[model samples]
Structures are given as structure tokens and as C-alpha cells.
Target: MDTRIRRGRRALVNWLERLHRLAPAKSVVWVPAGTFALILVLWIGTISRIQAEGREARQAAAGATSQVASSFAAHIDKTVHDADVAVRWIKYEYERSPSTFRLDTYKEKGLISAGTALQVTIVGPDGEVLQTTTPEAQPVNVSDRRHFLAHKSSPDIGLYISRPVLGRVSHHWTLQFTRRLNNPDGSFAGVVVVSEDPDFLTTGFNNLEALGVGGMLVVMSDNGYLLSRLASGEHASPVGPPASAYREMVDAKGEGFTDPVDRVPRIVTYRHSTQYPVAVLAGISEKVALAGYRHARDLYILMAGLLTVVLLAAAAIITATMTRLVAARARMQHLAETDALTGLPNRYLLTEILRRRIGRERPLDRLALLFVDLDNFKRINDALGHQTGDELLQNVARRLVRVAGNKSFVARVGGDEFVLVVEGMDVAVAARDMARSIIDTFELAFGLRGNSYVMRVSIGVAVYTAESETEYDLLRQADLAMYAAKEEGRSANASRYHTFAPDLAVRGMRDIERQQELQYAIQNNEFFLEYQPIVSLDTGDTLGVEALVRWRHPEKGIVLPGEFIPFAESTGFIIPIGELILEAACAQFSEWMESDPRPLYLSVNVSAAQLVHGDLIGVIRQCLERHSIDPRRLKLEITETAILKDAALIARRLKELRLLGVRVVLDDFGTGYSSLAHLTNLMVDGVKIDRSFTRGVPGDRTALAMFQSIVSLTHDLGLSLVVEGVETEQQVNWLRRFGHIEVQGFYFCRPVAPGSLQAGRAA
Candidate 1:
């Protein structure tokens, strides 16, 4: 037997030596074996880490939920205690003077406050509602109500809290705190109750972040009756009784369990109120609690799996695999830096380049950042389809790059905005030349979808002055300059490019300060209305008044419309400002109609922003209805520039207003490019010729002729005409020559405070 065993061992050793000699076989077996071993080790470690992390996450969640539950319990206990005190007070008052007791009188005397209870009621022993705090006390019987029966049957019951139920008197969901009221003989006389809205208990705690998604805050009685539940900041109805697992978790003070109803894992904690037979439960969704852990676990597992696959495959074609990985990384970097739509460097890459250039030991002597913004891009985009808009943006980018030349870098920063960096060889001059060239190129229409579309851009230039200027400051200055360019280009012949100046920075800061002040003004009612009467040339009597907004700045004394009107329009504060003016004007007009018994109308100037973005029609309707004023008494005066901006939208809105019986008119009529079109398309009831046209009126022959022609044309079109800025009697005389034309100017009355204006006359 020993000789046979020795022969077997010699045979095995020879076989192993032969196997080791085969290099390809060894490579095949060892590579997969090593991969398998690495994979097993990684998976084991990954699983262990994940399990430990999950446990830690659960423990943290349980601790947090327990804290929240404790807080909620304390809050509820205090709330119930206050309600019970109110109940006891009412019980004492009733037991002392049942006949003379009145909830209204107590409320009037400030003995009882509405904050503690939604309603207070007194129920006789027969369960008949005797008195209530509700304004309109209705007869109610609660013979079978749990709150009343619980208090009446047990005199020892100090304070019984009832589940949420519809109140017999208030007809709203409320929780009741009741106590038995006895006579002098110690017999059950009646029950005094303080009913509270369940929402009041949870409304004070608004930190919903503590309760993650699908989590809930619940207040339940000892018998497991849900009194109030809040989920996701909303009141929710009971889903049913708690499952056995949930009960067990509550009993343990805090634990993790799988909810049977939703089948979602949760970490739950509860606290029993020491003063009341109730508990507050705070449950956090385990999924949300361990979201970060799960994410890390998934990433690690995926990485490990990929590593294993790569290792196994890399043995063959190791060089090729490395080459492909390098190429893929390079491609990814490119993708990250490049804008997907315009194929230009994105904002990220632009920021990086700017920072690098600005942060160098020797900064570029002359670097310029040109911020280009497409004018009225949103309007055009909305007019044309998004597809066409995208195409247009792409074409614009190509043109910009072409105009910028190879020396400059052009990046599409965001939505219809591009940033061009010019350096070397007089960058400021180069920036100006590039901006002009780009503008000229855009002047020629671009063919999109077989249609020609002309687009314009506003360019702002900011040249680097010092190394102290940061990237953020540079960008902000450039952006401010761009807005300045846009504002300048509002006219037809103004320049579309502006250079950053010290004043521009000052203006930007002032604008921010003013915006905050304006917000405060709106909140504190610092704005008031001034009325200027519009007089009829024929009757020589005040016909209507134009509502003008005036800001009573606490510090500046008084800020005129011109000082902040344009800023308000730009910042979209004009919407709220306009609403206030409209409502005030309508209310004033309504009062005038009641006192004077004369037909009068009110005119409120509507900004272009208000016309374009505000709910003009709805505001008008609400004001008219609220003040009980006739819609015809309210006339909206929209500027011709506003109509020219979005003629179709403005016309539709005006038509809707007219249909509601409100009159519409055009202000600053002849200043816009499309005055005739506005008159015809807008269906306006009247036109107020701009103050500029009236400035040279009655004296300048040219102005008089133009005014005559406008009056004739307006009369021909059967539209009312109001000649504005009639400062002199001669102008009014000339206007009157046109046959009873309406006139408004300082000659009639300057704008005055609402109190200064009389019922039937100007101030």
C-alpha cells in the first residue's frame, strides 16, 4: 500500500508541473480566479458596510423622530391645557350665573380669546345647546355626542378630549375639550366645552423637513383613536388602525418597522402626554432616512462590478482598453465644457477661463468682456415656435463667433445671452469693433425654416481695470452695461452698445436699494393716489380725473412717478402698484358718484409691463365689483408704446375689458411708431395726444397743423381726442376750435391729493 501511494503522489506532481509549464492555460485560470476572489471580497465588504450604515441611519432617524415626538407632545399638552382652562372658566361662569352668562359678553370684555378655541358652547344636562360663542348662535342638540355624554356620565372626568368631529354649532371639524359642570349640591348640571380646530395644533410646527416624504405626525388617544394627522404639510384622514408592528414600535418608545398599509419601511417614535390621555407619534420614512446611504451603496456596488468586468476583460487588449478609456475621458471633458445646443463653450468653461486669466501673476493688460443679449427675445420666441427660436439662437451664435474672429473667445452663457472675451491688441477697441460688426451682421435677416427673421442684439462692454476686480464683479458690471444698452436702445436711433462706467455701478446699487424700498412701500401702504381732472372744452366743467400714483417716501418726503416709474416697470412692481391705483381710483370714483350725483369716470395709467404681464382685466373686474361702481366709470389708459409692443395681446385684453363695460384709451398716442394701427386695432374709445406734441401747440405752425390733422383724423375715425399739456389759454382756445375736444393740462388742475379734490370739481 505504501508503494502504491508513492506512485500516485509522483503522478500528481508530474501533472502539476506540466500544467505550470503551459503559460496560456495558467493565464486563463489565474485571471478568472483572481477576479473571482476580488469580487467576493468587495461584495462582502460592500454588504457589511451597507448593513452597518443602514443600522446607523435607522438609529439616527429614530433619535430625531423621538425628539420631534416629544416636542409635538409638549405642544399638544399646552394647547389642550389652555383649552381646558378656557372650558373651566366658562364652566365657573355658567355655574355661578347660568342665566346672565353670555359668551359674546365674555368675548367683548376680553375675558375669552378666539385663539384658544374656535367656538365655546354650553350644553345642559339634557344635551341642549344653551349658549355658544359663534356669532349666529343656532339651536343645537348633542344628546348622543361623545364629548357631552363622557362629561355628564362621569363627574370625576377632569377634562375629556374628543376625537375630531363636525361641531353641531359651527359645522366645521373640531376637537372638543369638555368638563362637567355641577350645581351647588354637587350634582351634574351641564357640560362646558371648548372646541378647537385640529389644524391649530399642528400649524404652529412648520418644520416639515423633520418628517420626510411619506412621513406623518399624528395625535392619537390612548384607545388608538386618531385626533389629528398631518402628512406632507397637509391634513390627512386616518388610514385605519395602527398595525401590530406599528404598535410595538410605539411601545418601545422608538423603533423601525414595515408599515403594513403602505408596505413602506418607517422609523417611528411616540410620546405620551402627561396631562392628557393621548400620544404624539412622529414617523419618518426609512427610504428617505437612508437615501444617502442607499445612494452610496449603489454607487460603490456598481463601481465594484464594473471594476471586476474591466479587470477580467483587460487581460486581453490591455493597451486598447487604456487607449479607449483615455479617449472616453477626453470626450467627457469636452462634453462637460461645451454647450450642447450651440456647440460653443458653456458658462462653466467661460468662468474657468475668465478666472484663470484674471488670477494670473501677470494679468492681461487689456481684457474686455462683452455681454450680448438678444432684445425682446422672449417675445419673439413666444411668437415663433420654440423650434424656430432654437434655430434662430443657433444662427445668432454662429454669426457672433464669425464676427468675433479667432483671437476672441465666444461662449453661450444662457438663454439668448452670450459672453465674448477679447484680449490682446487694444481689447476695448476690439470689443467695440466686434460689437458693431455683430450688430451689422444681425441687421441682415437670417433665413430660418424658409422664412426671413431679423433679430437685434444689445451689447455691453466691460474692460478689466485692475487685478482687484473679481470675476463676479466683472460679470455684474458687464450685465449692468447690457441693461443700459437695452434701455438706451428703446428708441429707434439710440446706440445699442454701452461701456461700463462708474455711474453704471452706482445706478445698479441704487436700483437694488430702491427695489427693496419699493417692496417695503407696497407692504406698508406708502403709496397714495393723486387725481388730475380732465376738463371738457365745451362744458368748461370737470368731466373725469386721471389717477396718478405718488410714493410718500418716509425719508425722501415724496417720490414722483418719473423718479421710480420706469424702475417699477422694469422690476415688475408695476403690477401691484397698478392694482393699488386701480382699486383706489375706483373706490374714490364710487364715493364721488354717491356724493355728487354726477356721471364721472376715472382714468388709471397702465404700464406696458402691466399690460403684458399683469391680470389687467381681472383686476378691473374685481375693483369695479368690490366698490359697486359701474365698469364704465373706470377707463384704462394704455400707452401707445405698450400697444406697439404686443399689439395682438394688448388688443385682445382691451377687447375683453371693453366687453366688461370698461372703456379703453391710448395715452402718449402719437409718440409710437404704429399710432394708426393702434387706433384701428385696439378699438380704443379715445386718444390722449402726448405732451410733447402739445408742447409746441398753438404757437408752432407745424405743430398746429399736425395737431389739426390728428384731430381731423380722430374725428373721421369717430374717436374721442384729448389734447394733453394744454398749459396756456391759447392752446385750449385752439383745441376748442376743433369743436368741444377734451383737454387735460396744468391749466385745468395739477394733480392733487384725493382729499383736496371736491365731489364735483377739481382742487
Candidate 2:
């Protein structure tokens, strides 16, 4: 058994040595035990001290409660004695002047108080006639009254206190004090009565400190009839004292007792009125009476609790310090090699892995590095907040890890860029599979904080070769390939990817220069607008002209919008470009309207950037005011793309435009990643079928049928239609079948300069 115990001890020691690398093997066992022992001692000592102080406070509270209860009972007894004396004086007054019994004379003589005595009355021998101090009193026979009958039957019944009742004349709950009146022959002739307002008697006691909030003073008959009680400021009852009250109160006399009254335990003091058959009960609610001592006890408890918290906080600080001291080197190493945000291998570790693999790996250990870049991540970060950006990056890292699996070394290089290194003769295929998995993962929406977001990843793939300069060159090539994928995505909304090549880097440089030149072009006003006339396919009559934006670079000559518009939109430069175009078109069209009122309307395209950021309505109104043009002749053409992204905002702005009488058109009718519901919902004046749909026209039955359907729907919905990209006469003649549908493309006339447009009108 002792050998087995030795083996167990050895096993524990080995386990501790393996787990705790910093601590020496011998001392690991005692350090934690010492800390625990110290904490336990502190806790026990703190509790002991608090309990001692609590006991002292309790004793003081009990003594104080007894003192307060005793004082309140004394006050009640004194009040009742005073009222008894007043009643006795009234009895004396009635005896002195039997025929003319008046409380006014007694009140003047200072023998009675109006505040305490509610009424004073006298009844004749046959209980037939009465006189009272109250005003407007009729004669009331007291033949059946207990107080009166008690006096009349037993001539020596002294000052008799009756049960509480509503006085007929006084009209308040009163306790009647009755005394017998005898003729000279010793026969009972009448009864003299004094009524006391029980509420008035208890009013002064209510204000006393002993009977504070939730305390009460009660006046009760010896037999348990409750005359009155005061518990207004307190939450206790005033209907009567509790059932057990009579035993404690009647027996207590001037002393107080601690007992529950009305199910609420209280420290009660009571006394019987010496001159009357009544008892005065004064009580302090046990809950309220112990408030002072309870507060002290609570303070002690709180102090002990604070001490315990302080002890715990100190222990935690020390423990944390010790833990960090033990793990400092390991944590420092981890931070140096790992990405802190997503816990992936950072650039430093990736470099190390590449260096080791290149130096030691076999010739057939081919490698591929995938550089993943999330598209539009920065826009989402800026718009939603950094928290969402962080969650997105973390989620992106997780997806890369999952797709890269165990064989690939997936490392987060930095901000939305991750490098995946894979090995095998077929590593390129593996890299492609990983990239596809990442793209597929991004297709599924990410739900966060009650919002769903779709993220797209642009991956650049580079395979290892003997010609490669170094591992850094591989990452750089991967980076260039990633940018190429992003460039490919610029033309479409979906995610795109590319493999590294020699010429890709050169194109990337050109794209960079182009972006720079685009910004410069905006500042230098190298942009101009051309108007393309929209002619009716049926008669070749010009209905309206669509304003098209063109940029004239000095070296590159005229550049089309498809080359720079996406970049402008991406960088938010489209807003300013759209503004410049609208301002110029509105000015030029207003001039054309004055010279030639040939039923011409001008359409200007509105970008998503302009609709969301710039105030389209305000700019158009300003343009109309400056040009003095009829708003009906001006059209703001917005593509269907903006509807799916910001439908609510665009819909509201378009409704405002419709109200302003500016004709609106939904441009690029079928190409947008939008729904038909958007077309129905928007308040537009016209729809321009995009040029792509027109390419399959004239002979393609599907194309003709679709156009015919669109024409019918457009006319039914009260919107005019325009067919674009019509280059042949046969296509135009066939399209003419749809009545009054406007056609605009290179077929009718290419986008011409404003001067050329005026010249064509002259011809």
C-alpha cells in the first residue's frame, strides 16, 4: 500500500511539472495551499468580527424598543386621565344646575375642553328628556343605552365608559362617559353623560416619536371593545388591536410587552385608565422599532462583505500577477507568432514556415500560396461600425481555416488578407478547391446583431516554382493576383479570383494610374456631356435626347464610361461627376428649349452614389431654377441597381421628384440585380430597355416576344418605352410594331456634341 501511494505521488509530481513550466517541481505543492489558508483565515476573522458587532447592536436595539414602548403607553394613560377628569367635571356641572345644564358655563369655568369632549348631555328620570352641548339637538331618550341603564340600575356604578358608537347629535364615533344622578330620596332620577372624541384623544399620540411610522396607539374596553386606534402614518391596522392584545395589554398595566399584534410582531406597552373602564395601548412595530439596530447590523455586515471583497480582489490581483509571471515567456512567444485578432498564424510565423520548408523540403513538395482579400469589406466596416468589421474578419478567418483544413497552413497576413500555404504535387488543385470553398462559404449570409450581410472574397493563387526568387516574392505575386481578382469583380457584383501571371502586375499598375488620373480629371474638368436623340422607331421622329457623360483624357483621348464609372462609384467620385453632368445638362437643355421648342425632352442618368449621398431633388430644383426650364421636359434616369440596395431611400426621393413634376425614368431596365417589384413600386415616367436585350432581336423569337411584352406592360402602366442598341433598319421596322416605342442607339445617331445636336436640328 505504501509503494502504491508513492507511485501516485510520483504521478502527481510529474503532472504538475508538465503543466506548470515556470514553478519548480518541489515548491508547486505548498504555494497554492498557503494562499488558500490565508484567504480562509481572512474570511473567518472578518465574519467573526461582524457577528460580534451585530450582537451588540441587537442588545442595544432591544433595550431601546422596550424604552420607547413604555414611554408611548404612559402618554396614552395621561391623555385618557385628562379626558376622565373632564367628564367628571361635566357630571359635577349637571348636578349643580340640573334644570339649566349648559356645557358653555363649564367650558368658561375651564372644567371641560371642547377638543376632547364631543358632547355633554343630561337625561331626566323617566329617560324622556335630554339636554346636550351640541347644536340642533332634538330630545333623545337614553332608555336603552348601556351606559345610561348601567348608571340607572346600579346607582354606584361611578363613571361608566360605554362602547364606541356614532353619536346621534355629535355625528362622530364617540365613547360616552355616563354617571348616575340621584334625587334626595336616593332613587335614580337621571344620568349625566359626557362624550369623548376617541380620534381626538389619539391624535396627539400619533405625532409622538415612540409611535412612529407603522406604529399605533389603541383605546380598548377592558372586555375587548376597541374605541379607537391611531396607525395612519404607519402601515398597521386601526380597526382594533390583535386578539392576543387583551392578554398582554390588560395584564401589562404601565409596563410594555413584545408580541405580534394583528399578525405583526410589535413591542407594545399598555396601561388601564385609573378613572375609566378603558385601556390605552401603545405599540411600536417590531420592524420599525428595530430600524436603528438593524441599520447598524447591516452596516457591520456590509463592512464585513467589503472586507471579504477586498480580500478576494487582493487575492485575484496576486494570483493574476503570479499567473502572468509564470506564463509571460509563452504568451510573448505566442503574440509574436500569432495574429491576435483571429488567432491565425501572422506574417512572421508564415515567413518562418516558408523558410524552413524551402530549405528542408523534398523537390516534389510543390507549394501554392493563396492570398484572399474580402471585397467591399472596408465599405461595410465604415458603414456598419468597426465591431461588425471585426466580426466579419473573424468569420472570414474561420471560414479560411475550415476550407484550408489541416494540411494547409492558413495565416491571417493582415486586414482582410490571409495566406494559405499548401503542399503536394497537385497543390494548385487543392488551392483552387480551398478558394472555391471560401467563396461558397461567403455566399451564405452572415447574421449579426439582427442584420444579415453577404461578403465576397477575391482570391489570388500562386504556385511555387524553381524560378521563384524567395517566399516573399511568392506572397507578393499572390497579392498581385488577388488585386486582379478584385479588378475582375469591379465589373460584376459577384466574387471573382485569378492566378498569378507575368503581365498581371503591369495591369495592376495601370489600373492604379487610371484611378489617380480619374481623380485629376474630376478636378481639371476634362469631362463633357453628349446628347443622343431618342427617335420613334415608327416615324424616325426625334422625341427626346439622352445626355451621356464622356471623359476626354489628354493622352488616352475620349474614354468610355464603362472604363471609369465603376471606379468612380466605388470611390464615391460618381456623386460629384453626376452633379457636374446634371448641372451642365440642365443648363444646356434649358437653352435648347428656348431656341427650338420641338417637343424635346432631355434624360440624364443618375448614379447610385448621387441618389444616396447627394440631394438629387435639391440639385435638380436648383438647376431648373437657374435654367428657367419646364420640369416636365427634364428627366432624371436612374438605373434599377439602386433600388435593390437602398429601395426605401430611393423610393422616397423619387416620390419627391414626381411631386416636383420632373419626369423620372428607370434606365437599364433588365440588367440590374434588382426585382420587377422595384419597377412597380417606383414612380417613374419611362423605362429604357438596356442594349443587351436588343442584341438578340429581329430574328430571335424569344427576344421579340420579350420586347413586345415589355412594350405592352410599359404602356399599360402609363410609362413610355424606349428600345436601345438598334443598328439595323429591319430591327427598327420590326420594333415599330410596338406602337410609339422610342428607339435610341448607334443606329439612329451616336452620342453627339451639343453643337452637333443643334446643327442636326437645323438640317
In terms of TM-score, the best-performing candidate is: 1
Candidate 1 structure quality by residue, lDDT tens digits, 690-736: 89989987778887777888888899998878888988877777777
Query: Model 1: what TM-score?
Result: 0.55
Instruction: Compute the lDDT for candidate 2.
Output: 0.73
Cα lDDT tens digits for candidate 2, 1-763: 2333234334423432433423343333244566567667866876676677656644554455456545545665676676667767666666766678776676677655576577777777777546777777877776888877788789888867776777776777777777788776778878777788666556666446655666666677765677676663533333445434556455442333554444555555556666556666666665676666667667766876676677667767766677776578568867997788777768987776676556555323278888998787877886678998888887776666666654565788888888877777788787788788778888998876788888888899988776445778788889999988988887787787788987986876776787789889989999999989988766667888988999999998999898889888877889888889988898888788888858788888888778778888889899989988888988888888766666677778888998999988998888766435656877888898988779888778887777777777888888888888888777777876777778888777888999887433311
Write out the backbone clash pairs for model 1.
none
Candidate closest to the true structure, highest lDDT: 1
RMSD of each: 44.0, 28.3
Q: Which pairs of residues clash in candidate 2, taking residues 3 or more apart in a chain or in different chains?
A: 214-234, 260-265
lDDT scores for all predictions? 0.79, 0.73
Candidate 2 stretches with Cα past 4 Å from truth are 1-369, 374-393, 402-456, 463-476, 483-497, 536-542, 562-573, 597-599, 612-622, 625-631, 641-661, 671-678, 691-700, 726-738, 745-749, 759-763
